[model samples]
Target: MNDGPGGPGDQAAYDVVVVGAGVVGTAIARELAHHDLRIAVLDAAADVGDGTSKANTAILHTGFDATPGTLESRLVRRGYDLLEGYAAATGIPVEPLGALLVAWDDEQLAALPKLKAKAEANGYDRTRVIGADEVYRREPRLGPGALGALHVPGESIICPWTTTLAFATEAVRAGVDLRLSTRVGEVVAGDGDRPHEIRTSRGVVRARYVVNAAGLWSDELDRRFGHRGFTVTPRRGELIVFDKLARPL
Candidate 1:
């Protein structure tokens, strides 16, 4: 809690409690600070970005491949613009390197036009179906039997580490109570006209509202509060990493 004027409460009762300190979690906390509310962001790790947020493919989604008019599409598009600007301002490493949907067969080569249409449907007009000659010219290191591809030039790579850290740090600097290694195991709702009591290893936390952002284990927290509408279904996307010099064959 910041001692600055109009800061969050310095007492035990927080106006809002947010679990998890990942990129998404910290962003929520940061946005909530614009309002007159006491927000506490908690993380189980020793520090923020120690979770899955620190890993995975560092590619920034252009919302080009995303389904049109979907929630993820809108957020990813807005988030792309938001992060691109934020990354520039905060010195977060980001390279807007274009990607080629490499094709090695006739079927995939035929997919280029359809994929281009899909990109147009998603509000991305820059995507185009390039010829095999242009494809090879763009990615000279591509493997043999390669055909044409759908070029999405907006895709970029970003530093996921700095992105999460930046959000968490900014939110902390903006008057958020960031608690590290503090895990809430149980939540006992107070009776009518009383604050909710959350039991953690350190002590009990009494808060007016609570948000569960605990990536994989968010559902468990929701169960304690007798709220069943929310369920956490983990979705895993696995990919193989490669250095710039490593070419597929």
Candidate 2:
């Protein structure tokens, strides 16, 4: 990455400016770098992946439980393959330990088949419904009362930090400018033959096109662009870390 210097006044006009340097933003920047466009990635944080992307569970899902026939399901299934391959190619650490959606009650146990069918519909057919005996056999340390489980062997864990860094690094190497600690506040449309003016905490950035990957602040950015198609409601999740002794479980 170019650690030389970054600010609005230090850079030239860009063909495309991608707001937010999280995983999604950096990925978009990297992909855009493949073209002939001059791209710039802006982030409020001091570094890439400093937002919610760093705090995620880092699970490489198999889309085994996504709602079928939706864009989310299709993208997730396709992204799984793409990211898995990218992780391998970039030498990002990945542990294909798989996962088991344990069913603790009769109602949930009955839903196993439905989940398997859903996975199939999402183009993932590697799911298997296993009884309690098999569940216990596979995970003997698991608590009792698991009626059954949907075993998704494609479910894996990856390094979220490495993944985002890989994307940012590749984007920078491919001639995409990365501007960190630059928070975008407003976007002003320009007239014919003029680039849009983006006001940021640091200074102004001029770009012909702007892409929003701002995650939680995407809705706010959309509103700045004179659109209110959706709202972003932040959700919280907790991650518990255990010592190596708990690795077996």
Candidate 3:
């Protein structure tokens, strides 16, 4: 992974330096590794998947709730299919149990058709609206009253750790240098034709190009480059895993 003597003065410059060893950075490095270029993936963490990449609900979402006609929505849909196939080909276990958007009241139930329409607009049309009877039949112990539900049979669950590790592993095997415990402190832009200097806790790294996939710190990194376009507001997402017995409810 080229951690030894990798400082700017000691090691040669890389063609591309991707900051952050999370799934996105690793995937980018893997994709770039196919070409004839020197590349490195750096992260502050001790290991890959040590950040938000490891903290997800592990749902292979279908982007059914995403607003249609948006870039994020489109990407989500495309990425879902890509990852689904990637999981199958690479042996990443994924359970396609689908999802139920339960509606408890008349107002929510009334929104089901619009929500279904939105899903269709996003290129998913497999949703089915089931009545209270069917909802209760499927989940007999469901509390009090679930007036109706929208069944999305394509939504599935996945293993986020395995997914990130798989990407990092493939990138490393494909000749991409994986540098851990490397925290980028500052970026020194190069003059025309010169390489950018990245000051890290470990040492300085010179790269012809840099990609910031730093997750929570991405906006901070962008500001380092003198950009004020957007800001990142970190939010907390909690996922609770229930036992198989809860399946009845």
Clashing pairs in 3: none
User: Mind giving the per-residue lDDT tens digits that candidate 1 earns over 1-249?
Assistant: 434323343336888889889888898998898888888887879889788898868899898888888998888889888989989999999988888897789999888888888888887899988888998888787777877788889999999998898898888888888887778878888766788888765566678888778877888887888878787777878778778686453
lDDT of 3 at 4: 61
Candidate 2: give its CA RMSD in angstroms.
2.1
Model 3 RMSD, rounded to 1 decimal: 2.0
Model 1 whole-model lDDT (C-alpha atoms): 0.82
Q: What digit string (tens of lDDT, one per residue) describes model 2 on residues 199-237? A: 877778889999999999999998988889899998877
lDDT on C-alpha atoms for all candidate structures: 0.82, 0.90, 0.87
Model 1: weakest 10-residue lDDT segment is 2-11
Candidate 2 clash pair list:
none
Error of 1 at 199 (Å): 1.1
Would you list the rank order by lDDT, best first? 2, 3, 1
| Candidate 2 Cα outliers beyond 4 Å, as residue runs | 1-11
Query: What alpha-carbon RMSD in Å does predicted model 1 have with respect to the real structure?
Result: 4.1
Candidate 2, which ten residues in sequence have the lowest lDDT sum?
1-10
> Going through the candidates in order, what is the number of backbone clashes in each?
0, 0, 0
Q: Alpha-carbon error at 204 in model 1, in Å?
A: 1.2
